[model samples]
Target chain A: MDEEAAKKLIVETLQKKKGKSKFYLKDFYKMLPDEKPRTVKNLVNKMVGEETLEYWSSGSTTLIGLKGVGKQAGAEDEED
Target chain B: MVEFRHKTPLIDQLETGPWTSFVSDIKREHESRMENPKGIDFQFNQDCCDDLLGVLELSYEHGRTHWKHGGIVGVFGYGGGVIGRYCDQPEMFPGVAHFHTMRVNQPMGHFYSTKYLEQIMDLWERRGSGLTNMHGATGDIIFLGTSTPQLEEVFYELTHNIKQDLGGSGSNLRTPSDCMGQSMCEFACYDTQEICYQLTMEYQDELHRPAFPYKFKFKFDGCPNCCVASIARSDISFIGTWRDDIRIDQEAVKAYVGGELKPNAGAHAGRDWGPFDIQKEVIGLCPTQCMSWDGSKLEINTPECTRCMHCINVMPRALRIGLDTGCSLLLGAKSPILDGAQMATLVVPFIKVEPPYDEIKETVIEPIWDWWMEEGKNRERLGELIKRQGMQKVLEVTGFKAIPQMIQEPRSNPYVFWKEDEVPGGFKRDINEFRKYHQR
Candidate 1:
């Protein structure tokens, strides 16, 4: 899929899940089933780099969400 | 270089114990660093050891800790392997104000050459606090304290000079570790170290990146003895076993019985537990009642043997693991966190563990990761998720058949969750039909 189309679909999916601001990368993989898993991952990572999406981590796990959405990363992150 | 700044009366009290104190270690490091220093960039102009002592003193004084968790701090292109930390009393302890931890992945079996060890120590001395935990709970060489800005520089030198990579820290595959199997142990059923290295190399991206919904861990054990405690501490535990009969040396067994050979490799030499009695100890202790002695020879009912390794542990000279060896793949084990602690549930009972363990990856690992990334909660461990979703779902997802070995015992409650499709008539059965039959 083209970058624009992938971004559009990803944004649309995140926007549609009104109650849930955060989602696993696989959630997007499910939304774009026709694309290869690796391809979807690359697109998502690209979006993250572009500030279209952000990562929210619990220190044990990380979830992807639309920029400035859902839980914020803070002092509660997992310690060594 | 900095001088001793804090007068720690409370910290001093701990040094009076029988065991060596960490306070002493820190004081020694403080003195040593003050005398001869290895420079780090962005110098706080305050000694880390001194500040560490100060923090401890403050913690003891306040009756609580003065450190707070800091936000994400990592090397370029990686989401894990570094944990950020900060002191609440930064003004009083500037050196540890931005202290962070870096977990360097250890070599297989944690076997390090003297040259490699020195290089790591030298590098750490230059770039961070010389103090280190030989290993952390997750089996990584933990570089305990460093400033945030120096992270990338330390990582670069570590990878370039020492030829070492960083271990996992955040919600990713924590460092894959195993006991020293074939390398140092005779009881090893399979090469645990080889598999650990292979898996670690294979899943480098997963190890260094934050991909999972929660933390995932993989631990390998050469035998069911589980020296590394994989069964209790990992998300996926690969434990070696065999389906064939336990190899027995009748002569050795006789030697043990005749008091010519020692039991438990003579490990209990300090205590006098009376003469070894095979009948009272070995045979009597077999969980399955599968062993017997017939005056001249010892016999084992191999078919009924559960491979619990009790008899083998007791009579190591006589008993050996079966020749046809493989490992059992168990899933979803972790410490007490969101869910209570759980030992890994048996999933695949036996698999021939070979190099580039593609069978394990395809059959178990990938499928579970795929499912977990989709269904697992934000901080839910795989074990907790498995418990919440039920083992039946795991069986279906992994394409494994349900076997009796998967569970400890059949459910005693008889509260079967009969699904609609499984029953002859669907769950939509009419109350009117029941009323017609009973005339209620």
Candidate 2:
């Protein structure tokens, strides 16, 4: 159950947030309410290693985005 | 005098123009309403409005009535009454962003016990601006100033002692309001006070929480005269009306013509609504062109007569609203934000509005919102959601699947986008197809 929930949240969050801009591991880590930073870090590492999520490094920060999930992701009605 | 922690120089600069006259007039109006202007405090509230003035000036830069941000503030498990505002020019005007407002839901018809009103006034004087917007566009008593920390405690005590709660805000059901119904108006067909009170109480939790995609408002008026103007303003509007034909008293009509009717017999009388004055005033002015008069009698064509209150208002002795009183429901009205401003659509032409109003909740109110909450976007209201996914789909989801109003001439109106699945099994294509079938 935890694994399924964690996977769903990661996919939905990546889909909702826009742009190629980098998201810091610490600030991004804070958004998960129930799961710990360690659990999320391990999940993120596993997913990145498996090529299910896009991950890279810019300076000391880590960034992640969707892996061809455009069809599944709904576009948010954001103001310009 | 209360010292200021926040001040905007731009507000002082702008006060010299049209604002000066506006402020002076409002101040005079405020003083007139106050019993003891100096007893508790009036100066603090004035300063609060002055602070908000700076924030409002910044809001107008984008477009009128559009806010660039949301910083809504309130007490625990409650997000209704208080509104927080911020000035856009942070560098130019520092510490000017924390301008806050408190809104008290207006009593139905603005009726209040003198003791209750005094209790509220004293409370406001002590904690908030003695000044207020008598009623705002949302039909709430808007108290103009207070900081964040002071609001929670003030609301807790005030709501408790006053036996009232704060009104709704954010993406929940906002405060529902109504004009004086049976309490004052002779034309009232349904109980405005009861409906307003019941809905407010039933949805109290919804009113406090920001759970919906956007805000919802409900307002009521007794008749088509629309004293509250609910048709253009509220998201859900219940207008008092009748399904049966209007009642007319012919003997009384003759009495009015013969100069034998009394002036206080409800409404019309003589030259000052006198006996001889009604034929032209009442019969001549009916918009539906359904009334006629001879020397001895008055005739009302029931089928042609629209249930407008003109004749009834002019000669209450001669005409009455029908016995089968009910209400009409309209949906989707709001000021423009993400979309253009919209007038409410006549969703339910007539529904019997008896006590409990369970039918209204079951058929119209709950279903429409259930669909909206599931499908609605961040700023999209029910009306706009209809535009995105078709009205056919909205009606289907809301359980009004086969309304006669939706089945009528579809080509005539652009908003009536019918689904192909809704077509009857043995349907004919058009008039030509119908004619061919008849010829057989």
Candidate 2 lDDT over B1-440, as tens digits, reads 33333343443455578545544543343344344445554424444443344444555454553222333245554545666543445443333334356778778877988998788877776666555677888788877555556677568767788876777666567889998998988789888988898988887766754445567889898887788888888888899998777788889887766667653354432346333565577777888889888777788888787678887766677778888888888777777888998877777778888878899888888788767766676567777877688766666766654454543366565555545665765444687868886975
lDDT for model 1 comes to 0.82
Calculate DockQ per candidate and list them. 0.26, 0.04
lDDT (Cα, 0-100) at A30 in candidate 2: 52
TM-score of each: 0.87, 0.70
Q: Tell me what TM-score chain B of candidate 1 gets against the true chain B.
A: 0.93
Candidate 2 - CAPRI tier? Answer: incorrect
TM-score of 2: 0.70
Q: What 10-residue stretch in candidate 2 chain B is worst by lDDT?
A: B65-74
Who wins the TM-score comparison? 1
Q: Which stretches of candidate 1 lie over 4 Å from their true place?
A: A5-42, A47-80, B1-3, B37-46, B413-440
For DockQ, the strongest prediction is 1
